[model samples]
Target: MLIAQLSDPHLRPKGVLYHGIVDSNAMFAAAIEHLNGLSPQPDLVLVSGDIVDEGAPAEYEFARELLSAIRQPLLVIPGNHDEREAFRRSFADFDTTSRSGPLHFAAGDFGPVRILGVDVTVPGLHHGDFDDDAAAWLEQQLAAAPGRPTIVMMHQPPFACGIPYVDEYWCRNGERLAALIARFPNVERIACGHVHRFMQLRFGGTLLCTAPSTTTAIALRFQADAEPASYLEPPAFLLHHWKEDAGLVTHLVPIGRFPGPFDFA
Candidate 1:
């Protein structure tokens, strides 16, 4: 199965600009166009989080239109910048319910392969959480599909990735999240966004990756004297492919075409 992952689009309402520099809406449109041009096309398009800048009604409308251009099924969840009520209202098709604490969503099952979208956004807070209800929901899903190859998706990464500013607001209940994930041997990978950079790490015996932002990045300034990584960086996303025999492989697809390949070696 082929899955295209795009994160942190941070798209704003029309005529609005993010941070007075990055053109988030334009960048996201570019990303959508690029993804639609893929050769075999993807079975699904997954937006890990930050689908909008402020969860504004207008922003969702724009996001919906842009995402509609994709010819494949699209799966998404809320990010720190997203509003839970707004997201639920927008994506009404997903079986969303209050269910005590956090909201849960799941879709698509190709026999032994299933995709699960879990919401971890804590309203009004920058950090994330898996809470007890969410943990139970995830466990139940994995348990029910013991023989299936499961791919878990969320907004914040469960592990630290050296970006202190982002790390500070990462998933707080990761220990519980990791522990819950370890029980499911069928789980092949965990995908997340929010850190505005492409990173890979291991957690709960599975691969975890953070997709690059389709919009601008959160200036890489780790501290006062540390250099900076900012909007100057090009936009990028991820293409994840999974096969019955080979497991899974992910490619970080940048938006713009690069100059002739240069030898890194």
Candidate 2:
């Protein structure tokens, strides 16, 4: 199965700009065009979160209009920038999207891989949570499919990414969640997106990767007091391909029209 992952489009209302600078909607449109241009195409597209800049209804409305261009199926979760009620109302027609409460869901019909999405956003906060209830719910889902190869998707990364500014709002109480995941050997990957950068880390007896945003790349800084900022670095996304013989491999693809593919004899 081939899966394409897109994160943090950060869409704004029509004729508006992201952070009053970048043309986020147009950038998102380019991402959609990029996805549609993939060879063999993807069996499914998984959106990690932050589909809009604000939790506003208008933002979701614009998000919906932009998202309609994806030819493949999609499963989306919410990020800190997404408002729950507005998100639910906007994407109510999607599969397994929670109609109320936290937007947690599990689906097994997408292909050989089973997808489990855990929403950790705390109503109005910049961080995420993995409390006992959330862990229990995850445990239940994992227990029900112990033999299935699974990909766990969430908005906030459970571990710190060394970027002090971004780490300030990471998922809280993540150790408990990690402990539980350690026992689930069928889990192939823990995919997350929130920091708007490409990163990979070892965690929970599996690989956890955070995809780059389809819009802006967050400034990469490790200094304790590094100023927070985002750049117009080339946009990027992730693709995870899985097969029975080769396990799973994830690729980072930068979105743009670069140079040519010369023949290498």
Candidate 3:
């Protein structure tokens, strides 16, 4: 199974641009085009939160139209910037059951690989957490499908990225999450977003990967008063390919490289 991951589009309403520079709408469009052009074609497309800037009704409106064009099945969760109610209303086709709207989740089986979308967004807060229910649900899901290679997806990472500002807001219940995941030996990786940078770490014997935002990347600064959140890093995403024999392999594929020769020897 091949999963294409896109994160942090921060889509805005028509005529509205984020920080007077980044065009969220155009960024997402390019991302969709790139995904569609891939040769083998991913079996699934995962949007790792921050779908819109302020979760405006209009922003969701445009977002739905763009994501609808993707050829494969898609999965999503909410981010700090996303409003759960608005996100649900915009993408009613997805599976959302949590009352707080932050824990919209779904489970799917692709042969020997079991994929789970875990929601860790905390409304009205910059940081994220996994409550009792989310943790319980994960445990149940893992137990139900024992010995199957699993890929868990969420917005906030379970490990700090060493970037102070983001690290401060790292998932509060991350330790508990790690302990729970450790029980499931089948878990191959934990894919996440929210820091806006390509980050990775080892958590409880599983690979923890943070995908770069489709819009902009946060500058690597530890200062408290870092005026701006993100800088002009080329938009990129992650592609995780799963095989029964090999478990999982991933790539940090950058976007917006046009007219470059395909052979980069």
Candidate 4:
């Protein structure tokens, strides 16, 4: 099974640009076209978070309309920039039981892979956490299906990615999350967003990967004093392929046009 993951699109209202630079809406449209044109289309598409820039009703409406064009089944979670109420109302069809409380946490089976989506976003905060309620709920989901290949999805990455500016907002109580995941050997990987760049690390015996935003990318800075910044680096998304015997493998697919497919002469 092939699962495509797009993160942090940060779509804005019509004619609005993110940060007065990137055209998030246009970038997202291009990404949708690319995904639709894939030779072997993805069975499922997961939009990790940051569906809009300002978390406004109009912004969510715009994003919902754009995302409706995707052919594959799409799953979404909330990010720091997302407003829970507006986001819930926008994607209400995805989870009907999510009318109240944290926007739905559940396990879904897609072929051989089981997807566990958890809500870690804290309203009006730039950071995230898996509090007591979320932790207990996640544990229940993991226990329900043991030894099944599973992918955990959330907005904030639990581990630090070395960019001090971004690390400052890393998921709090991450240690608790790691501990819970350690007990579940079936957890193949933890997919995340918010960093706006591709990042990977091993934690709790599972791979933790952050997908790049389709709009723009965050600069890679190792210096502690480096200010928050973004760049025009080619945006991209992740394609995770699962095989019965080979397990899961991920490929980074860049957006936009480039010369390629020339046969070696």
| The candidate that achieves the highest TM-score relative to the unseen native structure | 2
Query: Model 4 segments beyond 4 Å from truth?
Result: none
lDDT of 4 by residue, 100-199 (tens): 7776466465678888888898999989898998899889989998888999999999888889999989888999999999999999989999999988
The whole-model C-alpha lDDT of candidate 3 against the native structure comes to 0.83
Ranking by TM-score: 2, 4, 3, 1
Model 3 lDDT per residue over 65-128, tens place: 8888899878888888999888876777666445554555656643456678787777788788
lDDT of 3 at 230: 71
What Cα-based lDDT does every candidate model obtain?
Answer: 0.82, 0.92, 0.83, 0.89
lDDT string, candidate 2, 126-243, tens digits: 9999987789899999999999999999999988888999998999988998899999999999999999999998898889999999999999989998999989999999999998
Model 1 earns a TM-score of 0.91
Q: Write the residue-wise lDDT of candidate 1 on 4-92 in tens digits.
A: 99999988888788777778888888898888888888888889999998889998888887788878777788899998888777887
Model 4 lDDT on a 0 to 1 scale: 0.89
Kindly report which residue pairs in candidate 3 clash with one another.
none
Root-mean-square deviation per candidate: 2.9, 0.9, 2.0, 1.3
Candidate 1 residue pairs that clash: 220-229
Each model's backbone clash number: 1, 0, 0, 0
TM-score of 2: 0.98
> What is candidate 4's CA lDDT for residue 15?
90
